[model samples]
Target: MAKANKKDDNVVARNRKANHDFFIEDTIECGLVLKGTEIKSVRAGHINLKDGFARIERGEVWLYNVHISPFKEGNIFNHDPLRPRKLLLKRREINKLEKNVQQAGHTLVPLKVYIKHGVAKVLIGIARGKKQHDKRQAIKEKTMKREAQRAMKI
Candidate 1:
């Protein structure tokens, strides 16, 4: 019975700037704790992860700056657009992320948000900030790769 789902099929929102601003060393999929109205908004693809980042505090991961627009029909029970949401992960995984983030220049960034099997999940990355030169290098490499692909097509 159940049909297989392809990657990116259920992606609701993505932080495209995450890759350009930082180098993602590792990523972990974690569940999100959202209110009923928030979930409704997410299902409608009204979420933004552009300025989102996660922090480990008091042994729990809290996501900040991700904007989940309120449900249009949820007049009285609408959730705040910029509320900090809790991220669910195993204790071991949380510890690992905490340890990595303790290193200088490293931080946690929310990469994308998607619905999997009716549950909302977030892909968080352990990233290190990229310098100006590093960002330029990445851009250059991307342009070269695109040009190469065009040449191959010709």
Candidate 2:
């Protein structure tokens, strides 16, 4: 008998503003240390990544400002919505991220949150803040691209 493979990589939430605000240079997928209720809330799509960022603290990566709403049934055992959560990554990968973040104008921004193979994960980007002019240029390019696609369709 052959084993059937299940579809993986269910995205729970995305930080749509991350790309608009920063130029993403690199991305890494890391696991999140979620409490019981937190994971339930995540599966229910009650998580927000909009204002989330990661910081290396004491040689470990910590995710901050990501909101995981309290579980409906978790009256007394619910975790704090804005609590800092630990991100799981190999030591070498953490070191590499630390080195990259030490460069000027670079920071770690959470791009999205997802559940892969029943485990919660976060996709973080090594990004640099974009200038006002750069943002305008990006918007212009996007509009041009959309117009071109529309012209081709017609």
CA error at residue 111 for candidate 2, angstroms:
0.7
lDDT tens readout by residue for model 1, 1-154: 9888787899999999999999999999999999879999998999999989999999999999999988999999997899999999999999999999999999999999999999999999999999999999999999999999999999
Per-model TM-score on C-alpha atoms? 0.95, 0.94
Query: Model 2, 101-152: lDDT tens per residue?
Result: 9999999999988888889999999999999999999999999999999999
Q: What clash count goes with each model?
A: 0, 0
TM-score of 2: 0.94
- Where is model 2 more than 4 Å wrong at Cα? 1-9
Give the C-alpha lDDT of model 1: 0.95
